[model samples]
Structures are given as C-alpha cells and as structure tokens.
Target: MDAEIEVRDVARRYQKGGVQALEGVSLRLAPGTFTAVIGPSGCGKSTLLKLIAGLEAPDAGEVRLAGQPPEAFRAGGGLGIAFQDAALLPWRSVEANVAFPLQVLGRSRRAHAARIRELIALVGLEGREGALPGQLSGGMRQRVAIARALVSDPQVLLLDEPFAALDQILRRTMTIELQRIWAERRITTLLVTHGIEEAVFLADQVVIMQGGPGRIAAIVPVPFARPRGPELFADPAFHALCESLMAQLAPIADSR
Candidate 1:
C-alpha cells in the first residue's frame, strides 16, 4: 500500500536550549513520491524529518501518515529511517543486520530469510551477506544500512543524509544506487540533504528552508524525467535549476 505524509503548521521548540527549531512548517508528501528538504545548517531540516518519522513530537500542530499519527503507523512497522551513520552492529554480518528488525519485531527470521537475502542483493551486497560491517567500506556499510531499512518492506522511507560521510566520487555513486533502489519500490520518501544537485536529482520537489525558527522558503518542482542519470548533472537545465536553488538559499545562509 502507498503511504502519504502530512505535516500541518508544525512547530517545535527545545526547552533546555530555548531554541525554536521549526515554526509553521507544513508539507504533504504524496504516496509513493520522493521529496527532498534542503537548507543551510541549523535550518531544522533534520528536525522536520524527525517530526515526520515520529522520533520527536511537535510543540504544536499535527503530523499524520496515511491518516494515522506517525507514532501509530510506526508501531506497525510502516516506517523506515536511515541516518548519516550506518549504525550497523560491528559483529553482525550484512544479512544478520538486515534480519535484526524482524527479530526485534518478534517476526519469524526463518520466514523472512529469503526477503533478507533479496534485500542484500538489492543493495548490491549479495556476496557480502556474510561479511561483517567492520570489513565493509564506508559506502558498502551504508548500502547495508539501506538494506536493513528496507527489510521490513516499509511503506515510508526517511533518509537523513545517508551519503554525507562518503567522498565526492562515492557520494555520487551512492546517489545513483539510491535512485535505482528507490525506483524498485517507489515508497513514499523524504530525504534531508545538503547537496543541491542531490536534492534536484532525487526528489520530485525540492523544498528550501530558512533558519532561526526554521520555515519553508520555497518549494520547487523538478519536472525532469525519471531514472535520472549522471548526465543530468551536466545538462544545462539541471544546472540552471540547481543554481536557482542556490540563489534562493544564499540569503538564508547569510542571515544565519
């Protein structure tokens, strides 16, 4: 089933620090579509993602997934999240790590054995299923993390700069891999990224944000066709849109 996300006039404040991370933030992610949120540092990009993931509650307003509260849907294994850190168990093999969620949910590992293996292959980690995370490269580990996130067949996937740690070459490669993986399922996805090109390449809409009580600055639609390739990076139209987004974000960054 497809999943839709809605955040209505959401607001969040950190009482200890007396900081308002987000204010009057609202968005709707259509079912099976991809959306990327980009902004300068401390613009509450990650905060918005957490609110949508149900990892944190808003100080005011509401967040819903498929008409149910995020917490409610999340409890049913309908949500999956991957962060910059792979966070895989150093001791567990790739397949073992992927299967961990099912174990945590008290689902039968035996029943999910094939599914786990399939996800390993999907992330291009087929032969490495028995390899421990410690033995894998940074990008490989992140691929395992992606597989783990998909093991549950989640209806919604949230990515928090999953490629931020990789070098430029690896980051671009992973971006392509991610685009392919996302195409296979078309799960409703929200990605928080710092790279303007990455956001444009992967998202159907690019949401620019402003800091100091973060709020949406602009939402730009990406009309490019699907399965976007590396060549898109060199396309004049692509560069123009990215440059336009940069222009919009420049003032916001300066203000911060």
Candidate 2:
C-alpha cells in the first residue's frame, strides 16, 4: 500500500522567541496502517494531527493526503477524528450527535439515517440513541464520539488520546473493540497517545518524537501479528517490544 498521509520537512512556530512547536518533522502512513505517535507533552503530537486535519497550517514544507491538501481531503469526507474530550453536545442525543457531521456535509436526514444507525451500532451504542450525553457513562460517551467520527465513512481516522479517561479495564475493552473496528474497516489511522502499552498493542508502527522541538526520533515497527487482543499482554515478545519502546522514550520523558 502506498502512503496515504505524508508530512514532508514540516515546521511550525509561534509566540515570542520563535518558539517552534515542530521542526523539520516528516512522516508517512500507508493505506490501512495503524500508527501510534508517542512523545513528551510538548512534542507537538497533537499539532501534527491538527496539521493533517487542516485545523492548522504548517509554517514550512508540505502535508498531503493521497496527493491532495488535507483540507481538500477532509472537505470530501475523507477524514474522521475523535479526541480525548468527546465534546458531545450535552443536549443532543447520541444519534443526533453522530449524525451532525453528515448533516453538515449537506446530506439529508433521509440519506444519512442508515449510516448514522450503522455507526451507532458499530460503536456498541445501539440502544442509546435517545439518551443525552449527560445520561451516558464516560465510556459510552467515548463510544458515541467514536461513532460520530466514523459516521462520515472517512478514508482516514485521527484519534488523539480518545480513550484516556476510561478506567483500566474499560480502556482495555475499548482498545479491543477499536482493534476489531479497525480490522473491519481497514482505514488508515494515526493515533497520538501517551500510553506505551496502548501504542505497542494497537499500532503496526510506533513513532517516537523528540520533545524540545518536536521531530521524529525513531520509527519502530511492531513485531506482533494482527487481530491482537488482551491475550497478547502475556506474550514475552509483547512485553519485550513495549519495554524497548519505553527505554527509547525514557530520556525524552525525563527531560520534559
């Protein structure tokens, strides 16, 4: 598969003293590849995602999604995003929130009704359509967010700490669920997360970023085969790879 997302020699800066958020950062993602980016808090992991999502522009270099600008791609419904915040409207029911994006794209309610239902079901919220965000548990809210992100049937998915707020057990289950969802769709995905274990468990490749002025430190290909589950946690190879990535991030974390 060819690269679906590409960031070439990109740079960004803001504030006095020319504080750079990222410098000469470059990356590429293949079709259907799940990539997790891990780095210190100031490493601009989220900024990289925003740049790809067309929420921000890079100061230098080019960012392309399958040969088009990020905005153009997203405008065509080729991108989806889920963030840590969930950001659901408190008054909107789960179904309405999931259908918001499709509606914004000029899709009629009739045209998108089936897609919205499918997405809600896909995220395991089949029975919660009438419930408001306040009525749902944190995990359920996150599922609704995920469903909203996927409702557009985007070609790419960008997740920034989407499961950070869940309890450990719920997080693990959600991770398993996300893996299954990804398996079924095979959409190219880029995830920015702080969890080393989660990065290793869900990613085909893990990207390590240097903190001071974010740049690629290393790109580690995960050794495990796909259809991964909680069972992989006990495998020696899984622990070994997780430890290796942890060691690589140690200095970066300490410096922050």
Candidates' C-alpha lDDT: 0.93, 0.90
RMSD vs true structure, all candidates: 0.7, 1.5
Residue-by-residue lDDT tens digits, candidate 2, 1-256: 3239999999988767877999999899998899999998889999999999999999999899989999999998889999999999998999999988887888776788888888888888888899999999998998998888888888899999999989999988888888888887889999999988888889999999986788999999998888897899889998999989989899888987
Model 1 misplacement above 4 A: none
- Among the numbered candidates, top lDDT falls to 1
Q: TM-score, each model?
A: 0.99, 0.96
Top-TM-score structure, candidate number:
1
Q: How many clashing residue pairs are found in candidate 2?
A: 0
Candidate 2 worst ten-residue window by lDDT: 1-10
Q: Per-residue lDDT for 28 in model 1?
A: 93
lDDT by residue (tens digit), candidate 1, 24-143: 999999999999999999999999999998999999999999999999888888898899999999889998999988887788989999999889989998899889988999999999
